[model samples]
Target: MPDEHDQDEEPELELTSALVPFFVITNGRALPSDQQYERTALVTALKGTSAAARTLSPEAQAIVDLVAHGFLSVAEVAGHTHLPLGIVRILLAQLEESGLVLVRKPVPRAEPTDRELLGDVLAGLKSKFGA
Candidate 1:
């Protein structure tokens, strides 16, 4: 029979990694040191850069891994990592500086659509396709 005292004892708490403060993660800086990263800026791990990720913090490594497969905007990285936008920017700046990742500026918006050009293109496509 199980002892009553044992049943009353609180379940042993599972150990987990302690939370790291944001300040420590970003080395006490609120923003990236050099270039400002827009939330829309795309980031990707450079080819042959995964090796360098080993030298970074776990958070930084996670960022590298997330971008390794394809491009992701700064906002997406923050959401996936559950890290603050500022921290993601700081880490990305460091990774970019270290040549572990590439940060591409968001593409500039195209000038307002020219309806005349669209109509011409549509006419050409229809003629070529006989549709």
Candidate 2:
């Protein structure tokens, strides 16, 4: 006799959530120094190898690489690729929408809650006392 398990079944209950973290988006261009070096090496290798470069459309790949390395801005990528600035902005937006990358913007400060006000006061005191 053989025993069978139904591996095809999946749980259907929906676990709902509304919480979003403050860092839902991060600046993708802030690579550490070591990572930048690694990325540069990889870029050089890709540029040097014809077969490897052919596997990826080098034009698009270059844009992606530079953006990932945080070494190029959308405007810079556009200028290098000879693409329009609007087109570059659109492509960056697409990357963000696809979750392939994140772009950080300054968070607007919220009005102080009681807890936040108290915390700020304590922080001020600590700074004044060099604590």
Candidate 3:
């Protein structure tokens, strides 16, 4: 027998049926066997976003709403929506195809260093403070 607390927990979302139509509609055919989307890619809603939002599925709409606030990575969307990462990727690809969302690769950040670019910070600090 399951614990009472277990019964109170929300049911897990099922995507197989719910996402099938989205995949078909977006692809204009069956789901692809192999589609690749970068998990770290950032998504942003396009301009005139309200009209575009109206054309999306409820799931896709939710994703658009989240993206409108700010750019969000693919993994972030999956986490926020509680959808599987693969589903989010497919949905994002559809949105991207329609120009409703813009997907961008995350910019690589420069590594931090202890060395200063111009000169030693201590020399400048000593000169300014006169200690």
In candidate 1, what are the lDDT values of residues 14-89, reduced to their tens digit?
6686578887887775576434688899999999976667778888999999999999999999999999888899
lDDT of 3 at 23: 51
Assess every candidate by TM-score: 0.65, 0.33, 0.56
**By summed lDDT, which 10 consecutive residues of candidate 2 come out lowest?**
37-46
- RMSD per candidate (Å) reads 8.9, 17.4, 11.0
Clashing pairs in 3: none
Give the Cα error of residue 14 in candidate 1, in Å: 15
The per-model lDDT (C-alpha) reads: 0.85, 0.46, 0.75
Report the lDDT tens digits of candidate 3 across residue range 46-130: 8787885786777889998999867998889989988777778878877877888898876667878667744677788889998
Residue pairs clashing in model 2 are: 29-70
CA lDDT, candidate 3, residue 21: 53
**Which has the higher TM-score value, candidate number 1 or candidate number 3?**
1
Q: How many angstroms is residue 91 displaced in model 3 relative to the true structure, after the best TM-score fit?
A: 0.5
Weakest 10 consecutive residues of candidate 1 by summed lDDT: 1-10
